[model samples]
Every structure is written in structure tokens, then in C-alpha cells.
Target: MTSDRVPVVVAARRTPIATKGARLAHVTAEHLAAPVIRACVDDARAATGARADIGDVVLGNCMGPGGNIARLAALAAGIDVAVPGMTVDRQCGSGLSAIITAGEAIRAGDDRLQLAGGVESASTAPTRTFAGIAYFRAPFAPSGFPDPEMGPAAQALALRYDIDRHQQDNYAARSHQLAYDAHRLGRFDEEIVAIGDVRVDDGPRAGIPAMLGRFAPLFAPADGELNGTVTAGNSCRISDGAAAVAMVPAGSRGTTPGLALVAAATVGCDPALPGIGPVAAITRALADAGVTLADVAAFEIVEAFAAQTLAVLHLLGLAPDGVADPRVCAQGGALALGHPWGASGAVSVVRLFSRLVRGNAPAGTLGIATAAVGGGMGVAALFKVVR
Candidate 1:
């Protein structure tokens, strides 16, 4: 939207996503991000025909070491030491927030070649404890509201939205199938780089249809009446991965831009149902971009949980059967790829870029990346491919 300098994504790439405590357990977040960042810079140079002197790098991270992981990653990637780097945190929204910030900076003429993305090392991140009193993953609410873990919140959201266990199971099965098919077809090859021995996403198991209705209730007690639909089979598993995208002004170095960051929005909602948060953010982002949902050719809604994904789609009047909708995560999503916390949102951005620029979609197509965050928040970004 800026008249001075338009923000565009020239290239994008990501490391092979591995399940937590699996293949990536021994790799640090910085190590995982370093090579991907370097590869992305190389990709951007190829796309834009730019000199290698890229500008600042920004990365999103959560539960990593205390220092600025971005700086370390830049150094490890052998990027110019003078090119500064920083890290931002917005919990689950961290990655997309970093991308939005980079685009805004580009629009503001802050830098010519900027690298922005997110990295998470859930496998290596240290566990925290309150003096051995309790171990917690995260809280959905702050304090006053009835805060719950993500599983319970998703279950509650499903009940409120009238989505049943059967529907969630079907969605899960669909996710695995789509992911399996995409992998077999090598749809993800353009974006994925092998990290150590992991050549592809280590999540997404085949044969979901046979096990659909067999997952035990996760959030309900044995005698309880609650029919919780959120289960490990249908929810995103914690994973380790890193992803990066290069941003440059539209006219910089004659770059044939793959996507333009048209608009972005981050909104807060009732923490009681964090899964529904993306609804408001997506609406706002579309409004900001001066477009309607009908204009969007592709959609990437973070699949934190099957119930959450279904709830957001239903609330927005979009088809809850996103798997059947070619425009919505047609290549599979977080449920199958696994969620690397801070990196997942950036992964969505990367997916949009690949779908558009990898000759899989037509030019000028619009895409949206949206996510439901922990502690009652959502983030959405709009993009359009331009040759």
C-alpha cells in the first residue's frame, strides 16, 4: 500500500520440519536457522539479481536461548557481521509478526534487502519449572478469566461451535492424506532443505482413516460427560524447524516479485477460546487490504487443532471442509506438518510464496496467512503475487 516503496517477497525457503525429540533434537535453533537463512539469501539473489550485501535480518523466536538468536544465526550463516539482526517474540504469532514488521520496514524504505523469518527448537529448548512445584506448557488466559490449556480450550471452542468428534476426526484424516499425497508428489521440495538426516517433515502419518474414531478423549476424565474432540491425533504436535523469506522493495534490482505484503493485522480476543481469535484478525486484514474473502485465491489457516481450524472456518462462513477446498491449505497444513511454535506462522508465509511462485498458481493471485495464538490472540497477513 505504500507509494514510496512496495514490499515484496523475492524468495523463501525452510528447513526440513522434524517432530520434537525426533531428528532435530540435537540441533540448536540457531543451527537450524543458519543454513536456511543462507539458502534464502542465495535464493533471493537469484530471484532479484542483487549483490550479496543484504541489509538487516529479523527473526522470531520463542523458548530459545536468552540472547538474540537472530544475531547468532546471521553469524553462523556467514552473513556480513555488520548487518545487524534482531529477534521478536509474540508467542505463537511471533513468526508472522516478524514478517509483517519486515514488510512494513521495506515499505518505509528502511532497508533494500531484508531477511525475516522464525525459528523454533522445541526439541532442544530447556524445560522450565516453578521451583519443581509445577510444569506447564502455556496458559490460554492471563489470570482473571478461566484459563485452560490449549486442548481444553479447543474442546470448549468445538462445543461452542457445535463441531463434533466425528467432524474433527474426518478433518484429521484429511490432513494426513493431503500431506502424504503432497510429500509423495514432492510438492514441498522447492521449500525444504535437509537438516542432518531429516530430509522431509517427520510428522504426518498415513492410515488416519482407520484410526479416526479410536483416539481417547484427551481433556475429559473417565467418568466425566464432556465429549472432548481435541486429541493428539487431531491436534498439531510440537516440532522443531526453521524457515526464512527474503523481502525487498518491488523495483529493487529488477526483482520479479513473487508476493507483495498487502496488509497485516494482529488482534486479541477472549482468552477463553483462543482458537476463534484468527476470525477477527483475518477479517481486519482483508479490510485493510481493500479486498474481500472472495478475492483471496488461497488461504493458510494454522491448524493448531482440528476443532480450532473448523471453528474458525465455520465462524467466518467459509467451508469447514477446508481439505476439499482447493484454495484453503490445498497442500496440507500444520496438523500434518507439525507446529514449531514460533516458526509455524512463517511456514505459512513460505507456503503462500511457494504456491504462487513455484508455478503452481497463476500470477496476481491473492493469499492469506492466519493463525490462532495462545493467550487469546490472532495474526493475519495478506499477500498477492506480482510478476
Candidate 2:
């Protein structure tokens, strides 16, 4: 493929994230994604004063019905049927993965505009069962890969890395504080689309108390010597949400293009310690982008678990200790906003668009959206302000 065109994000938006069975409980995944998809198109139209001419829509989904949720969302949003749609699954990385796919396609000289994002409606998700078995999701790991659910894996990482419960709670508290502050400042107003009565995220609670440490560890192992530091406060909650971005090639947009996709990388690591994937993935992405850590102005690292996020921070030189550095997730992260599986990573991209593209940051600023996925995968995308 020739590099005649560059991938750029023109517009982005998301529905208010709701905890499971909360305000968005009645909506299906496609139902939740439809409005945001429409809104993104509407925004692109208003910005450019012309139809977006979207050629395809790619949506990321996990635990939703097996049928193509992307096609459903597209039709529901009134997108032309001529515009085909596809769904992608990278588990937790599905959302950002979809965006990266679309961006790469755009960069490869595709003339059509693409709308890519992700959605998850845990409230409407059917309880999945193993084939002819009672277990949910799956039963066992493949031969040499040691796979554990995200919670257990985070617990193991905390034990191996010596992150304590207090430290984790402190990190959680900081996340809540930052999210609350951002909400109060209306920092998310440009990105949040209405979903029923919910106008803002429903997960953050300010003033986290000292008593958080008193709660029992949710993922502690019975045989392990360490009391697991991963807790409800320090971990993301299951939620329902959807996010979408409007993208087109360089110099071809009728709409205002914000961030140019400079470079991206998706890599895999040891399954047992999958959280470390960001370190390697981001390193390679930065190298591809031809910049160092100091060149990045902001970060949107998905906080799947406080321990895992802390580990990535340290590995990336953003933190000297296991504590969070303010530059990362300055407005909050999945810890405060909730994690809607496939939607969380897309939300990170929207966050980057918000803080760097529209915030007080200067032009040419650089930002990254990184997420550690289930199945030992990691994705990192580097974006730079072009306006």
C-alpha cells in the first residue's frame, strides 16, 4: 500500500458510561452505539458543512450477540445500507483495535471515510455458557498459555510486583478525585452524548474513605501468601457504553481533522502477566513514531486495574514508584469511569481527542491511547495534533 494518504481523526463522541443495570440497562449494545454513531456523523457534517460520506463502519464488541453488531448499529443510526459494516473482537482491546484497523486502512490509501469505535452493553448481554457445559466465557486455557480472568491476573501481578493494598486504594482514590474534578469542570462535555437520563459517567464517587482498606480482597488466592491488592475500588466495574470516531485521509476532509495517526502497534506478551504488554507495545509505537517518552504531552492509559496501570506507568518511566503520575490519565480513567469491555479502549481515544485536540494544549502536541487486553495482548496508538 502507498502512503499517499494520512489517517486523521475528524470527530469523536461517546454515550455516558453507566454501571451495569443502571440508566442504560434497557438498551442493547447496538441500541447504545447507534446514537453515538449518528452523533459523530452529525458532528462531522456540521464541522465540514457537508455529508460525511462515510463508506464503512467498524465496531468492536464483546459479550454481545454473535450477529454483526456493527451492521445493526449502522442501520439503526440511519447510515446508508450501501455502506457495509463489520465487527471486530480483540476482547478488551477490541475498541481501540477497530480504530487502529480503520486508521491503517485509511493510511494505506483508501479513499473512503470510515467510522470506527466499540460498544458493550453488559446489561443486555446474554449469559454465555461453554458448549454443552455450565461454565461461562470458557473452561480452560490452551496448552502452554496460563490464562486467568483479568481480576486474578491483576492480583498475581500485584503480588509479584509488591504493590500493596494501601497503594492501590490511594490510586483508586486519586482516580475518583480526578474524574470528579473533570466532570465538575465540564471537561467531558464535548465528548459525552446523552444516553437517556444519564449525562455524565455514573461510576466515580468523590471522597474515597480510609475504610477502603477494610474490605476483603475480591481476587485473593487461598494459597497465596500475599493479600491481594486488587479490589472493587482499585479495579474497573462492569459497565455499558459506546464510543465512535470519524476518520478520513489527509487533506481530504470537509470536516475539521484533529489528530493525525502517526504510528500504532499491537503486540503480545506472556499470558500470566499480560498487564506488562503496554510497556513493550508503547515502546515499539514510540519508536515507530520517531519520538521518545518526553515528546508525549499526555497519556490515556486504560486503568483496567490499578496494579496493572501502575506497572505500565513504572515501566514507561512515567512513574518512579508504583504511584500514578499526573500526566497519565489526568482526567481519570477506567477506574473512575467504569470499563465496558470493548468500549473502554475507544473511550481512551476519545479522551485523548478531548484533552489534546480541544484542550489548552498547543498544536503539534502528542498523545497516546494504550490498553492491555485479555489474552496477553496490548495496543498502543500514537497521535499528534495537526491543526
Candidate 3:
């Protein structure tokens, strides 16, 4: 029996990665989320030309106080108090999860209009709330579990994948080239929302290899046994940003005939190798979509680190050397465009949408966005442009 597929359409999209915003050395977390929500809501309303009431707000934020960030952001955006809001956490995949949750709600016929997205402010990373807890007093136990830090897990993946520091540096360089090319061609301008004076992703550099050479290994200690290939140069940088997307039922008014989420998959992995989670999630998403790696025209793999991306590519049989089609982030990946944790997944969605629209690729052009989470969790979503 053929199962009915519920359509979740993008009614609006917005991101705040302004050049001026990046120049600010620091900004309060609350301040960051507030303006972003307003900008996104305004854009969504304009795009749809329908001022529909938002039925729900789902936000993803990894580092925040008490997990009420979504509610706070919604309130700050002047959303009606009657609208319910909830915050979620899935490490780096939190943003994508937020979008997925909203879409699922719509698919289930639970709500008509939903606001979903993610935000991060590394400039104001909250201190660990329970540093004095008993968990910290325990002696180190070696069950092969590395520190809970995401970077260390990425380093472990580098070791497992046999990726080298030089290769990582090269990948980072390419990310810069691609990001720069996209910016020059005004590809990002579509989804980018100007806030104050900031416009476009302020952190993407032009030449990443030269920048990588200036940095040292971030996770591996100089004197310790070489643990892995992950490096600051190859991994995403700390950043502050926010992204939001408005979703409605397929037949909803003001729906854009663009990309739509085809399938979403989330998977668990050995916490020791958090970076590899994307491979499992991506595989599931591909299977559900009844497609293969060869069917995609471009990929927007979140570059949490070069090692992690390389590993996922190998698993999908689409490693850089293996596939001939150009990946959207062809210029550079997260290594060049600072990854803002919860915000990165949403950023990937925006980037993918822009590429498909500008390139005018076939409606079948598939795009995938994946992210590695703390504790070996990964999430992926497949999207296809609507003909």
C-alpha cells in the first residue's frame, strides 16, 4: 500500500550573519537572539504576504540558561504570548531538529503555521552550571570515552578515518574559496537578512589555507601521543549567529515552489566517535528517500571538521575524489564559515536553498545537511526543489 506523504512547505526563511555584527567583540546572548527573531519573523511575513499567527515556536540552542531560550526569543520578537514555545537540544543538530519537529507537527496535521530555527552566541558561552557536582569529583575511568567536548570526538574521528592534518588544511582552504565565490556572486544575499549594518556571513574568509597555517592543533596536545588529525584549522570556529524558517502545509497560501524537506533521520553512535554520527543519519535519510549518493547534484555537509566530513563521505561512497558533482559549500565548509553550534544546521539549510535557486538545477536536485552532536549523536535531512 502506498503511504500518504504530508507536504511541509517553506513559507519563509531568514538568517543573520552580518559583517558588522561579526565585528562586535562581544554581545549578550539575550541581545543576540532578540534581534534575530524579529528579523526572521519580519522576513517570513513579507515572503508569505500573509500575516498568519505562529502556532508554535521551536528553537534549538546548545548553550543557554535553563533551556527557555525559545520562549524568550519568541517573546522578545513580540510574538503573541498565547503562542507556546519550547527549546530543544541535540547538540549541533539542535537547529535541524527544531525544523524537523516543526515540519513533523505540520505533517501530523497538528498545526498550520510554525516557526522553527536555532541560535548560538559563542561570545557569551555560559559556564558549566554544575562544575562542583559529584560527577566532576570522580576519578578518570578509561572505558575509551573521551572528554565530553565535541572537538575531542572530532579528533578521534580523524584518527579512525586516517585523515591527516595536511589534508584537513587543504579542505579548509577549499571551503574558503567556495564561500568567497558564493559571496562574490551574491548567492547568500537571498536568505541573508540585514540587521543594523551587518550583512552576509562576516566570518567566511577568502583564503583558508593561509589562515589554517597560522593556527596550531586545537585538540591534540603537543607532548601527548598523537591522538588524531583534527585541528583548529579544519574544524568550525566559535561564532554567534541565528537562523529561522517558517513552514506551513503544502497547500497553505503564499507557499514558495522551492525546496522542501523530503526526509529526516537521526541516529545514535558511540560517544567516543561523535563525528561519525552523520554517516548513519545520512544513510537512513537516503534510504527513506529511496535515493543514493549518486542521485544528488550537490551536498552541503556541515564541516564540523574535515575529518568528520571525510568520514561521512567515505561511508556514502562520495568522498571528494570519488564524486564529480560540485558540492554547494564547494568554496569551503564550516571551517571557513564559523559554526555557531545550534545555528549551523539552519545555516546549512539556508545555504542549500540559495544554491538550488541560483543554479536553477533540476527539481530533483537533492541536498543533504548533517551535523555531529555531543555523545555520538547525528542528524540529517534530505531536501529537493519542487518543480
Candidate 4:
């Protein structure tokens, strides 16, 4: 919202998302991020016809190695040695949070170019332990609060919102179908930066519509009954990937067709029903941008789980049917592409950049990138195309 020195995304790039313990199993988080960072900076330089002198690198991470991965990633990307880097953790929303933090820095008068994004190496994440016991993940809520595991929480959200298994299956099928089609049509060509030998996403599959009904639900009812609707088929695969964007003040963007940071919001909700987090965050971001759902030409809402996505869309008054609305994810989403936890939010932004800027959308075309976090939170950013 700064009158002067508004933040603009000049270039966006991402490593192909790979399923956990699959194609990217041997890669580390910093290594996964390095190529994408280098590609984005190179893209920005090419666009503006000037060498990039990055001031900082801010990245998000969840289950990667605990050191400052952003600094390591920047070094690996061959950024100047003096450039400082920071890492943030907001669970699944960490990537978007980092980008918004960089935008705020730009508004605070730091005119230097910045690289902001997220990375996750679920395939190589270290096993964590407390005392003598191994733990799968950190508690979303402290003791005495209801912090169900993510799958159960998603199931709860679906039940509470009446999103049935059929609806979830349909949504999942469409995601896979659209993503597969997009890949086949080269829609993701410009945005994907190959990592080593991996050049394309591995999660999207053909014939998903025919296979979805065979999946069994993953969680039980709250009363210990059977037949929960949140199933493996409807949830995003654990993935390894990275996505980053080159950002500068609007004045420095030259004639590039990029997304201008219009507004962003992060909000919290009940940890027990964390899947609903995006509702308030999206509402606040759109309100701040002085626009409505109808005004946005594209939406990239990190589909961690079909049920979660459906609940968010339903609460927002958008039809929950994925195939009915091409605007939500014009190409695809995390459900079909894969969800690299911390990296998914930045991936959403990259998708927006592709769907709006690279797709030849008109100037001032509006887009929203959003995600629901693991621990009762949501993050959303509003963007307007500037050519």
C-alpha cells in the first residue's frame, strides 16, 4: 500500500516438485532452492537489461535442516557474499509470509532487489526427537488445546462443512487432470527451473478420475466411527521443491509484465479446525485491495487437501466445484502438482505469475495467492498485473 516504491515481482521460478522419497530424495533443501534462485535472478536481469545486485534473500522452511537455509541457499546460488539472508517458519504459509515480509521491506524504503520464496526437502528432512521419544511434527497448539493431526483436522473441516467424499474426489480428479493437461501443453515451461536431472513435476498422473474412487479414507470420525472422507487420493503428496521470485521497487521494473504487490494479510484461527484459516485471510486481503472475488482473474490457493480447499472456497462464496471455475487454478494446483509444505505458498505465487503475467493477461489483471497453514493460520497476497 505504499504510495511510492511499491513492490513488484519481476521474475518467478521453481524447481520441479517431486514426491517425497521419490525423484528428489537425495537433494537437500538448500540445494533444491539454489537453482530456482539463480534462475529467477537471471530472468529479472534479462527482463530489465541490468545485472541484479540482490540485497537480501528471505526463504521459508518447515522440516528441513535447522540452520539458516536461506543463507546457505543464497550462497549456493552464487549470490554476492555480503548479501544477508533470513529464514521464516509459518508452517505451510511460510513461503508467502517471506514474500510479504520482503514487500514490507521494499515499502520501508529498501530499494535494493530482493529474492524471497520457500523450500522444502521432505525427502531429506531429518527425523526429530524430544527427550528419548521420536516425534513426527511439532505441536500446532500447546497443551490443553485441541490440535488434531492435519489429516484428522481436514476430515473435521469437511464434515463440519458437509463436503462429501464425492466432492473431494471430483476436486482431486480435476486437479490432476488440469495439471496433466497443462504440463502436456507446456503451460509450465517458463516457470520451471530444472534441478539436476529433474525437469518436470512427478505428481500429476493421467486417469486420476478413474482411480479416485478406489482410495480409502485416512482418518476416523471424532466419535471413533468409520468412513472419514479425507482420503489419500484427495490430499496432496508430501513433496520436495523450491520456488523463488525476484522482486524490486515498481520504479525499477522497466517494461516487464509482472505482478505488483497490492495487498497481503495473515490471520489465525482455531487450531482444531485449522483448514478454515484461509477464509478470514483472503477476505481481509481482498478488502484491503478494494476488490472482490469477482475482480480477481486468477487464484492460486495451495491445495494441501481437497477438503480444506473446498471449505475455503465454500466459505468464500465461490462454487466448490473445481472444473466449473477455470479461474481458481487455470493450469493446476498443489493437489496435482504436489505440496512441498513450506514451499507451496511461494509456488502459489509462481503459479499466479504464470497464469496472469506470462499467460498474456491484460494489465491490471488481478490474482490472489493464498494458503492455509498447519497451525491455525492463513496467508494471502493480492496482486495486480503491471505491464
In order of appearance, the predictions have TM-scores of 0.94, 0.95, 0.87, 0.98
After superposition, candidate 4 runs with Cα above 4 Å error = 320-324
Could you tell which candidate, 2 or 3, scores higher by TM-score?
2
**Which is the leading candidate under lDDT?**
4
Q: Residue 140 error for model 3, in Å? A: 15
TM-score: model 3 vs. ground truth: 0.87
Q: By the lDDT metric, which is better: model 3 or model 4?
A: 4
In candidate 3, which residue ranges exceed 4 Å CA deviation? 1-26, 131-148, 219-228, 253-255, 320-325
Error of 4 at 25 (Å): 0.5
Clash count, predicted structure 3? 7
Q: What's the distance in Å from true for residue 343, model 3?
A: 0.9
Error of 1 at 295 (Å): 0.7
Candidates 2 and 4 compared: the better one by lDDT is 4
Specify the poorest-scoring 10-residue window by lDDT in model 2: 132-141
**1-387 in candidate 1: lDDT tens per residue?**
454477788888899888889899999999999988998889888876667467788898988875899999999999988999989888777888888888888777765688998999998887767767655464555568866678888888777777778888888887888788988988899899788778889866787667867778788622366656678888888999999899888767474767888889999998878888899999999998789988998898878899888888887877544433567787888889899988888999998887787855666799999888888899999998887
In order of lDDT, best first, we have 4, 2, 1, 3
lDDT digits (tens) for residues 114-206 of candidate 4:
999999999989988889898878988899998888889988888888888989898898898889999999989899999888899996889
For model 1, which pairs clash? none
